[model samples]
Target: MKIEGKNVFITGAAQGLGEGISEALLERGARVCIADINTEKGEQTVKRFQEKYGQEKAIFLKVDVTKADEFESVFKDAVSRFGQIDIMMNNAGIMDESRWELMISLNVMTLVRGTNLAIEHMDKLKGGKGGLIVNTASVAGFGPGFWFPVYGGTKHAVIGFTTSWAVRTHDTNIIKLFILYQFQCSKHQTLIEMQYKFCTGI
Candidate 1:
């Protein structure tokens, strides 16, 4: 899809990979809504973007992705601000083994919620323009992670969930779903590699 003039709603965009994605989108002339739990960093990121890309190019909304209400509200607010959302990037995730349940909630459940909202707002059959939903998974989803078993499990769940929706929506052709896998070489790995797959169906 063409990136210019597209409106993107992205989570965990305050820093890291999400921040990079937001910057790339803006550089390509897309308007981005940078949603994150970290208000301070999020504001700073948006400020920087606005200064570089112009004031209307980006906006920041503080959001807790694990909460259904807050997550849904971000979508509503993004649509209100941008007029319509053309891309939804579910990039917020954590790898906390101590708090495994929260990990599952943030990494898996919240992503599901975000994808659903994207479909609801962008499906052409529902009187809205069709768009793309990009879910962030990890290389851990492909195999065992002895040091971070729970984190790996959450990523695995993400892959399964996104692919399932991809198949479900194939016939309609109203929305496109994609899986983005992040890979790190080792514990001391500073560089991150990203791989994406376009889901056609099962």
Candidate 2:
């Protein structure tokens, strides 16, 4: 699993943890597709990456991850641009208790959709090269969060869904699946450490 020359598709990559992961990937010579709902920020991020990593190292695709069709299209467009995606990172999520339903859609449903799309596109059995699928979860998923009950529940769902897929896909050991438990810390530091551990099998 060399990072150089690999193509990565990442959601919520316009800012925060996703953006940090994208930066680390690009630094390691991987081409990235930064998918996010924020068109302005996403494009801006891409521009910065392109300037630093070369004009073809990264691209931004505006995407509403909750929309299955739009999300799927992002994958297609990314593949069309990069030839293939070697890594899929489902990092789009929200922590709004006032909008719990949208939280579920973004944190849980969209993650599942993204994982499925990754499998469909990268599974060796499906006439494609195998790749890694990484889903971001919170520490709240492992326990109760009274302050943000619904947000915690969505994180719980993320953990459950990702672990279930890992178990189900054990027999077919081509495509790798992982869940990244995000902890409270400096965003870039934590994500860079976690991404290093996972990508390098350290």
Candidate 3:
């Protein structure tokens, strides 16, 4: 489908791959909602996009995906600002060292909360063609993760969610689900499938 004219809400859009994806979508003339905890950085990114492409390119939102209220409010605000939501990427997440609670909140709870909010908008599609949801995961979920056991389990959960929900959502034609694993963010981040682990001796 054509990305132009589609309303896509992206989380964790302050930097990294999320920012890159937002830039690409803006270039394609998509209405993008750049959401993240780093409000200043997020707004700055939007400013740069607008300066390059004119004023109506993107909007920035300070969203903490772990908070149910924030999740709900972000989607609601986005819908209120822009007619409807077409695409969603549950990309706002964090990394912690072997902390089970931190891992669950960051990797799993964020996706749960964000998807719940996003699905509310997605299911309201007319003609069964609103949009899709994409999730980010890691290779460690499947393979043997040496240190981050909770992180691995969380990704396994993400995989399960994507596999089970993709075909069952309301808008079959509108809904497309994508999952990515083991994308190297930087040298410090380890790819479980790769042998060279960044063993920081933490």
From the highest TM-score down, the ranking of the candidates is 2, 1, 3
- CA shift of 76, model 2, Å: 0.6
In candidate 2 the C-alpha lDDT for residue 174 amounts to 40
- Arrange candidates by lDDT, descending: 2, 1, 3
Task: Compose the digit string of candidate 2's lDDT tens values, residues 1-202.
Answer: 7889989999998987788778888888899999999999999999999999999999999999989888898789999999998898899998889998999899889998998898888776678787778888878988898899998898888888887788766544445445465556676678777667655771
The candidate maximizing lDDT is: 2
Between candidates 1 and 3, the one scoring higher on TM-score is 1
Q: List the residue pairs that clash in candidate 3.
A: none
Q: Global lDDT for candidate 1?
A: 0.81
lDDT of 2 at 147: 91
User: What is the lDDT for 154 in model 2?
Assistant: 86
Would you list the C-alpha lDDT of every candidate in the order shown? 0.81, 0.84, 0.71
lDDT for model 2, please.
0.84
C-alpha lDDT of candidate 3 relative to the true structure: 0.71
Model 1: ten consecutive residues of lowest lDDT: 193-202
Q: Model 1: runs farther than 4 Å from truth?
A: 171-202
